[model samples]
Target: MFSFNDLLTINGISPQDVAVALHKPANTSERQALCTMIDEDFAAFNAYQSTHARIPEATLKARGIMASFVMTSDGRMTFVGLFANAGSQPFAQAGPHVYALFVRMTRKMTGPDEVNGRSGLEALQNRLLFDLSRLDTMSDLSGRLIVQDPGARNYMRVADCTPLPVVELTKEAQMTPPVPNWDALVLTAPDLRKLPNSWRVQLSAWRGVYLIVDRCDGARYVGAAYGSENLFGRWSQHVAREIGITKELSQCDPAEFQFSILELLSPAATADEVIGAERKWMRRIGTLEFGLNT
Candidate 1:
């Protein structure tokens, strides 16, 4: 049958000094591209060997050669990184560690299927998280290469040279200004639960006028938030109920709804001021006359 040896032959590498054959499959295109990038960028390092070597004594040396292969989640092989540097540490034990690399997939890799499954928090927790601690669940790096280091080994080369995507947390994002135009913040119904705590906190801090446009039709709804609950709190209420308070939104599929903040009000703004802004927006947008703000 096909084996690692066959894989090596296909790639034109002699399989003699190989320490281990590692195969990890990345199901998404984003991941597939990363595999290619890591291999190309680190080719020289991957080719270096220990002192008992024939090649030039290079600055970077690989402890052992490893063949990294990536495939789709369904097992369709896509990319491979031959002889990638095995990081010093093999498995992570605890977290709050910064991931050197990461990618934002179109959907969570660890959750249940949308069609026949409940979209619950627990299901979301099942996906591969950036801050990983468990080794058994290494499936999160499903299509990436991993080595057990059969023996405790160290290479003279650079450590942790894997190309990892930089991650900017929600708190870090808050340090930057919000969208210059407040209305630029848009969300789909499914996006609400995924909001980071920092983002939610910032949203809840603002009492604002917002719009929900039904993309299915060109109809829109203008609304306001001025109560003890701010924009975030109001959105949380919308997340709970399918229809919300608007008949048009309730009748339309959640996928057809796009939510945006039209205006931000000061925390000290009175209820009258918030509603007045909402009404003015509704009048300007003609939502009350032809849209969904009854």
Candidate 2:
């Protein structure tokens, strides 16, 4: 039966003072005192660190204190506290308001696994502290884009951008035209994996999508076969034959030609939605490639 007195003694605070700071009436001192006790206990529990050593003072200042108790959707007790702020006053003065805000935020953001069947306030406290730290680091870009390299297990901030001018080495160099192949194109394993196993029944189905990409100063065609399997092999062969015949007979050597299967989309999905998603990915990949090349 831990009580407000216990919390006050541990944190060097008085129960009555906590009540006053929290703006709870002394007549309901027991309830106010209990709330303060829980808040302090959770805060201290979250503050402890192991491998990371001490938490930075600046981080604490920014995110405020964390707690070891989290409120659940079903109104049950969990030993996990989330990142929290105590406002700009002592626990007694700001405790109630902060606790209410913490409860509200937890209800909105967390799922059942996070707030259920947990004990050991320290564990909950530590998890929340780590989360807060990560969020703070992510948000502090300092006006630059922050990207993570999973292979290297590190992060980098890109700050500068300088474009290189496209140059033509020879004055007689001519722009090569593209050769479009009406035939089928070969798809990669990743592209093939996008379609479901049931798509094999409809062999002639080609309602997927296509894109024109610039690769190595040449145009490359990419197509996807939605709800279709074994289509990539047939399409690739067809495309190769078409390109071979057309480029060999053309006066101007066709620009380097290549093709790939991007991805399969749902049958009901719209072209605009699919294209929007593709464009977003392309932009990201293009930015990374440009940065690496430069």
lDDT of 2 by residue, 35-58 (tens): 322333433222232012133322
The candidate scoring highest on lDDT is: 1
Q: Which ten residues in a row are the worst by lDDT in model 1?
A: 168-177
lDDT (10s digit) by residue, model 1, range 1-294: 334344445555455534332223233433332233333333211211111122212322233344333332233332233343333321132122212111112122221123232222232332322111112222223233222222222222222332222121122211112332456677755555445444566787889899887777767888898876698788766656556555656776655567789889899999999999999999999987798776
Which portions of model 1 miss their true places by more than 4 Å? 1-181
Q: Evaluate model 2: give its lDDT.
A: 0.30
Clashes of 2: 11
How far residue 114's Cα lies from its native spot in candidate 1, in Å, is 4.8
The runs of at least 3 residues in candidate 2 whose Cα sits more than 4 Å from the true structure, single-residue gaps closed, are 1-240, 244-262, 287-294
Per-model lDDT? 0.46, 0.30
TM-scores of the candidates in the order shown: 0.45, 0.19
Model 2 Cα shift for residue 219 (angstroms): 9.4
Best candidate, TM-score-wise?
Answer: 1
lDDT of residue 72 for candidate 1: 27
